[model samples]
Target: MRIVIFGGTGFVGLNLAEVLLARGHEVTLYDRAALPLSAQRSLADYGARLKAVQGDITDVDTIDALVAEGCDAIVLGAAVTAGEDLERVSPARVLEINVMAQIPILQAAIRHGVRRVVNLSSASAYGAAGQRHQILDEETPCDPVSFYAISKFTSERSAARHAELFGGDFLSVRLSAVFGPWERPGSVRDTPSLQFQILAAFARGEPALLPAPGIKDWTYAPDAAEAVAVLIEAERPRHRLYNISSGAAWSALQWGEAFAALHPGLECRLAEPDEKTFIKLHGGDRAPLSVTRMADEFGWRARFGCAESAAAMSAWWMQHKEWI
Candidate 1:
């Protein structure tokens, strides 16, 4: 299958691209700029199953043509990341980049006879506080507090509309905090969050950040990417939204400490806590639209489980310092 990925230059996209290529699928990456040096080097090592095309998301006709050129499906992974300066970025910019940009692309794909589209959604759409492991699912009400979350939610709605209005098949996956190999340095590096801090400090040969409260259900990137590919290959579903995750909880410190134990000299220490940073973990009643559905419906399962995957990532990063 020929699959097209937007924003395939970044960390998650790079991992996804590699996985798709390894599976013997032809991959064309559409991005505004050339891939980073590391990505280029890795692509060279991985051979030519993958290729890159330069294009802006704003170019509707170009995107249409690309989709029409024997590409069976579209995977929308492009988006401006979360920002600290929300006001400066503005809600308008978020809508333009995340929401509006996806519409013309999806419309063009439908017009050009693309069979399916996999839109990447986010857990942040639940808003500022979680309902104590509320088991946030596809049916949960959206109360997006951040511009990034709002944009992701709005994009999913737009994709669903495209599916309903134009007969285009679509699957939107609400991904949780995703981390694994091929992660870009500086993106999560030095992050105040306990897990990343520990990972980052160890990477830098420093002390890991140890904290009890920073928790998240971190899906492994390769696993997450595999889920996206599976959804694209599946039949159109009555239920269009699914949460792709490990669906398990762990503190940032727990993850960091475990990784730290793997390597000597790297150790973890607690930093001063910030009340605002605590995540409201969702609860059990919700039964997050399990990837078990993907498994049952499409024969999908995580290639790597959470803790083992995190350790693999740490070891991979440690060995390939040049890649980071």
Candidate 2:
């Protein structure tokens, strides 16, 4: 299969590219940012199977030309992960990139007779509803509050509507808090994951100070990418929307401690009273997302938990500490 991933230079895109390339598929990575040297060195073993193209996502001509060439599948991973600060500074930019830009891409996919289109959404789409509900499923109502959340929810609806009207195979997966290999600070992504923050502190030879026990269903990036790959290749998906998550909540502080155990002389603990901390949690803890739909349909479940992900990330960090 030949697949194209928008925002391919970003964290999740790179992980998905590696997964697909390892499965003996051709992959083209389309992104605004050039591929990082670190990624180039790591992906060198794949040879010509991987191609990275730098382009503006909003440029209809470029996107159309690329899709027109040929593609077996398309994964919409481009997004502006804005927080309140960015939302106030540039709200329209968020909408333009996260929502409006998707229209032309989907249109091109439809025109070119693409097989499958997978829209990468976030659990942030759940918004306040995530906090209110004890368990968030596909049927749960969403009251998205942040600009990022609103754009994600809007993108999902738009993709579904396009598929319904045009008879295209479009599916959206709402991913839980994703943190693992390839996650780094970038222009579009304002908030780094808690695990990233903790590991960054470790890289700097400092104690990881936590504001709180940041607990949520933190999905490892590789695991999340594999699940999205499943949806892209599924012959007949039972549902249009599905939740991808670890399906269990655990404290990121615990993960830090686990990593600390692997490396001696590193401190991972809570901040003292009245002490300032650099670590930033995404938001207050919310209910974990239910993976029942994915499990039932595809026999998929996240393999990494708090401890396992910690160990895996520790090994990755040892090799790619410069990425921090």
Candidate 3:
């Protein structure tokens, strides 16, 4: 199968690109930025099976031509994450990329006869309602608080409305707590991940300190990529929206302990109990997204838990230190 990832050079997109190639599918990554030389060298062995191209996703004709030229499906992985530290970046740019950019992309997908379209939405769409867990299922009403959250929810609605208007096959995946390789601070995903902090600190020969309240259901990159791969391969999707995740929550203590055990000197410690940084990755129900729908419909489930993911990611960063 031939698949095109719109933001293929970013962290999640790069991981997804590798996974799709491993599945023996031809992948063409379209992004505004160039991939690092290290990543290119690591994936060089894939040869013609993998490709990275520089293109503007907002360009309708280019997308239409690319999709019409033998692309099977499209995965919309392009977006500016939550906060860009406006002092160093523009504020409205986030909304511009996350919310407004989906219009032309969806139009091209529908017009080009693309079979499947997967829009990468975030759990933030639920806003403060499900921040503390609340077993935030797909049915939860969206009350987006932050600009990033509002954009994500709005993007999903746009995709659904477009599909309804044109009778096209478009879907959205609400992903939560996803962190792994190929992810770093960039134009698309600017937030730093806990895994990267731990491993990067180890690489710098220092201990890592994390915020309090512990995080849960952190999805490893390879695992998240594999789940998306499975979804893309599904012939007929039962639901337009599916939550792809580990569907379990864990604390920073678990990951910290795992790192301590793996590397003698490296430590993953939580912040002071009274520290205002006592941030919770999940809320209410303390559960991430429920993968029951994905499992039932497409036989997809996360294969890695916190412990396994920690160990695997640690080893991976060790071998690919350039990524850290």
RMSD of each: 4.0, 0.7, 2.9
Worst lDDT run of 10 residues, candidate 3, spans 277-286
lDDT tens digits, residues 1-324, model 1? 888988777666788888888777888889886777767776786566788998888898888778778788888987766555542546576667788999888888888888878888877666643554457766667777667778888888989888888888887888877777666534312222334445655656656544344566667788888888777767666578877887676665666667767777776646556522222222112223345566667767666654587578777776676653
TM-score of every model versus the real structure: 0.86, 0.99, 0.91
Candidate 1: Cα lDDT at 74: 84
lDDT score at residue 265, model 1, on the 0-100 scale: 76
* The best candidate in terms of lDDT: 2
lDDT of 2 by residue, 1-324 (tens): 999999998999999998999888899999999999999999999899899999999999999999999999999999998877788889999999999999999999999999999999999999999879999999999989899999999999999999999999999999999999999886788889999999999988899999999989999999999999899889999899999999999999999999999999998999999988999877677889999999998999999999999999989999998999
Q: What C-alpha lDDT do the candidate models reach, one value each?
A: 0.70, 0.93, 0.78
Q: Model 1: clashing residue pairs?
A: 132-282, 132-283, 133-281, 133-282, 133-283, 134-282, 134-283, 135-283, 210-269
Q: Rank the models by TM-score, top first.
A: 2, 3, 1
The local distance difference test score of model 2 is 0.93
